[model samples]
Target: MATAKLKMSEVRGDVAVGVAQGGATVHALKLEGGKNVPLCPTRPKNGLRHMGLAHEQKPDLELCMKCSAIVPTGPVTVTKEQVSIPGLDRTVIRKVVRPVNDTDTTTEEEEAPVMAENTTTADPRDAQVEEIRASIERLPSLLEADNAEGAEELNGEIETAIAGLGGKGVAALRKTLRAERDKALAAGEEAKAAKTPSAEIVNLETKELDDNGKALIQKGIDKVKELAVNKFQGGHAIAEIVLDIRLGITTKNGYPDISADTDLGKKVGGALIFDDILAGLPEEGEDEASDAIRAEIGSIKKSARNAMQDVKVRYVRSLDNSPEEAKKFGYALEAHPDKKPSEAVFTFHGIQSLTRAEQAKQARELKAAEKEKTRLAIEAGELSEEEAEALSSDGEKSEKEKRTETSNKLKKTALKLISDVKGIEDEEEKDEALEALTVLFADLRKALTAK
Candidate 1:
């Protein structure tokens, strides 16, 4: 004869779980499978009762044969009257421990939940921008590490860095190139510096033919000058300045002080340079040598300095965001004297951009997903084109085998969602199911190519 206790339950579906003698637990036994994953539902035909596998079903533990009982299975409490067993102290710590702090709720009206519209006008630091900046800065380092790439990834970051410093630096660079070009013109009444083959960066193939049928290959030495990072003839003088700063050169103002100075000046001057680089440039030659070489050097130095100053002449951008942001920014720049400063226009509002870090991550993931799908397609030979199209939610998915497989998958997914909540409120379960489906569909679509 089998023996088990009856415990309270909810409805037609009830779990009966208990042990017979000798501490043995007999449940829905192995049919052919090794285990019964859930509780046994077959029980006495009662709508409101079932036995639990806990103390209510403790094999050796006994209860009076005629007694009927209702016991709390989750938590236990003992009353003073139940402590009659000699000196058994029945004091219970009855404090309900909450997992989250209810009182930590914010009460400030100014600190109310912010929407994306309001977030745009706020400081970038308040948003998740630090990681973006960190990643952006790290890009150069990553490219340097991956030097074996066919098309170096560092080129884009270097370009972005050059583009980001949009200030007097760019203008200074433009003027230096133009001045050098004009000088090249003066060198020859019309003979340009060795026309197309004259320059590496200039593509002679794209060169417009002159009247003499010569391709103007020479874009000018100024083009090559921009390429000089240690110094520069590269078109952008600001890029040189940024590179110089990156290289740990003492930039007093902006121009590289190539002029010879005393050892004491070099040592003590590193301290004195940054505050007055441009101020020191023109003033230094006044008291120095009056020779031709010296004058040429002075002229070149002036030309370069003039490059950056020209940018300021046309456009002036305030560096700070809010007054507070400005103060903090100045402090950081001052503290990290060697680092490059961003030339973002201080729009009176704030950083003027609102974007979540997840958006960037999602974009990267989407690109990766597309590539993966293309690779899989190539391996499978199911699609002729390497690219996959953006699919509609309800796409005309053909192929009997694919449809059967996909339908089976959808049925399993719906079953899993339904099983996640047992007879709960339909509204909450539906919401959860919808959220799961959205994630599932995105992943499925990303993996399936246009075939």
Candidate 2:
């Protein structure tokens, strides 16, 4: 048997162009037999012979089989290459020849290419500095336009470009940039100030209280008396009044109650009444008492401060309301006695500070809670006695150990609370208690393990 010979004329499909394994560009003839015949151009002549066509010289031209016409396969026009060199006085430029097959066109051309100056050479550092200077000059306009992001990006570019440069030039440019930024900031603040209204707190003269105002003031006094009798010692009359006022327990007339039965309270009350009379006594030109209220309020506030040093008073208020309103009311309480009853109506509430005995009770409860927690953890086999003792010891423990102890305590509390819920006879009460306990336990667990 003889091997069959391959004929190019017998090839019957489309022709394709590809690069050879060695990186030579060649034409492949697709054959009816499903094989490719790669055709390489002859060297020196740079001509290809295929399908009976001989000595085809133009590399960029490919032959069309149907028309037998040569067509260009790539770009037709040739672009000239130029190089730019930035100088102090002017940019230097030079033109160089590039071959058609070079493919690399990375060098970007200037919008208006210019001839070079004879005295200068191309220096990249000079170009970088010029670019940085241009960016710095544009920053103020960018900021004024509120293009802060663009300004920041440009600033980074400028800094990076000037990082290698030294001496007064860089320093001067940096100073100019800082000045521009500061000016922009000042202008913004000035515009803001122009748009914002200034608040004026007027100290109005106190007017005589009407029937309603008197009744409200009496109510506030009664509330304070109740607080003092129940929680505070006799010596803490001033502190009690201040605390009551702070707590928003104003009289039905809206005036904060400053009345107390103690001697100190009597003295303070006299001063306050004097202040009120002076406030309402028809201004008749600023009376001494009008100015004296400032000193009086200040003195009372100082005494209240001293009282709080040894006591823990928690003032509860609406989340949406300002605490400052209550404070201002307290300051203006003396003027309340002189104001109309309607105008004297205000709200105040205060929780009395824990007494020494109460504090001891809380401490005992906390210790009992800790003991219960330790017992529960031991019973659950989650903690050993040795570990529990170490945790309870006076020796400093790591944060992890502290957290573990807290978690154990919270778990014990949760279990006890859950058990107690079962004893509630009312289904609704039991359900409510269980729901509240669940929420509390979840919150405590999160707190104990929080990073």
Candidate 3:
């Protein structure tokens, strides 16, 4: 007997939407060849759209779903642990952390909290019902407030009446209004407004989501040390992690530079160091295989990114109000025949695609990390402090190891930079550089940790 309704998440990590907890076990599905395929089971139709994910999408699941014949979603749109329901004026009300002690006062230096995936949440219908019931109970006072729109004395009295209820009380009123709106929607009375606020908007301001590096920085710091030490035979993710490592190792010291100067001092200074790409190659090997492979791989990825840059750049119209600009644009109605130009909202789906691609890369990285872990266990007992110090070579001195010497030196350099950055005056600049170095040394340590 199922004690409770089961959700997709409860049944398996792969299913994101439908199932609930305490229901029948989701049977393992297989194909004709016996390979397990990603199966998204049926989910009831829901009107509200979520972020379409509770967390970073899992490799094993289809995060999006299409459902037809959603009659009414019972006012609850549940996506994993999160839920929301419609409110008055097409608003949505849902549970969120209510910060105490003036949250709005945060300074720019204060880093914002990372967004959390829906670990768990109740149905939004619950809020809707609760709101409706509460509003029904307080109808008299609510009616009074509605009646006293411009009466200051009545307004104070009404506010005092609602003050005890807080956000929930306000929500109750919204729910009442939403119910009316939905009823009108079903009756086709207000079809235009029924689409909700989102559908009709030409544009809406949105917070720019943090890039993957920024989002993963702290998590990486905590987990990367262990992850980079891996080695998977077919894994291609080493380049990304290595790319991260290189970034980490690059010191903030102005890169070695050749400066062009007229009669005066150094001007138009440019980096003197060769691109330290392929610098990770184990210096000497009988085969020289990894070198060629890594170089080609790096070059290929670089070319892909470079090729996309021009294609991705979209020009937005320059804001022009000057008299010459007005003349060129044809200020008089008869002068300008062309229609008024619409604003260019340049968007590139590249970031989203790149992220999806990188996810596969990350998987490969993890796989390699596991393999490398096993390899290290055999080659090395453990790196001693003396050996660790010996590897911390810089400039001309650091190059004297076996072909794998550069790998070890990078780690050593990472450690040194992390320690050195503490005394730097600029905290923001130092923090980023430190994280990059941390990622680098951490990756290198994986190679030698076992030996």
Cα lDDT of model 3 overall?
Answer: 0.35
lDDT over C-alpha atoms for residue 109 of model 1: 47
Error of 2 at 211 (Å): 63
lDDT tens readout by residue for model 1, 1-451: 3323333221111112322211222232111121112133322121111123222244443321111122212222222211111112233222111112235574434332221111113321222223223334444333334332421343343333333221112344334333443343344422323342445575546655775444334544555655454243332354235323432433454322222123433433233433344444545456554343344544445444434333321222323333542442453456545643333222211222322344467767887776677667767987654123323122434355467888899899878866664445543234434545566667778888646
Candidate 2: where is the Cα deviation over 4 Å? 1-78, 81-83, 87-131, 134-157, 160-235, 239-357, 360-380, 383-451
Q: Which model is ahead, 1 or 3, in terms of TM-score? A: 1
Once fitted onto the true fold, the runs of candidate 1 whose alpha carbons sit more than 4 angstroms away are 1-127, 147-410, 421-433, 442-449
Which model scores highest in TM-score? Answer: 2
lDDT of 3 by residue, 285-348 (tens): 6447966666465444444333332222211122132334333223232233342311211211
Each model's TM-score, in the order given?
0.17, 0.23, 0.15
Q: Which ten residues in a row have the lowest lDDT in candidate 2?
A: 110-119
- Once model 3 is optimally superposed onto the true structure by TM-score, how far is the C-alpha of residue 157 displaced, in angstroms? 54
- Higher lDDT: candidate 2 or 3? 2
lDDT for model 1, please: 0.35
lDDT of 2 at 100: 27
Total clashing pairs in model 1? 17
Position 196, candidate 1: lDDT: 22
Report lDDT (CA) for all predictions: 0.35, 0.45, 0.35
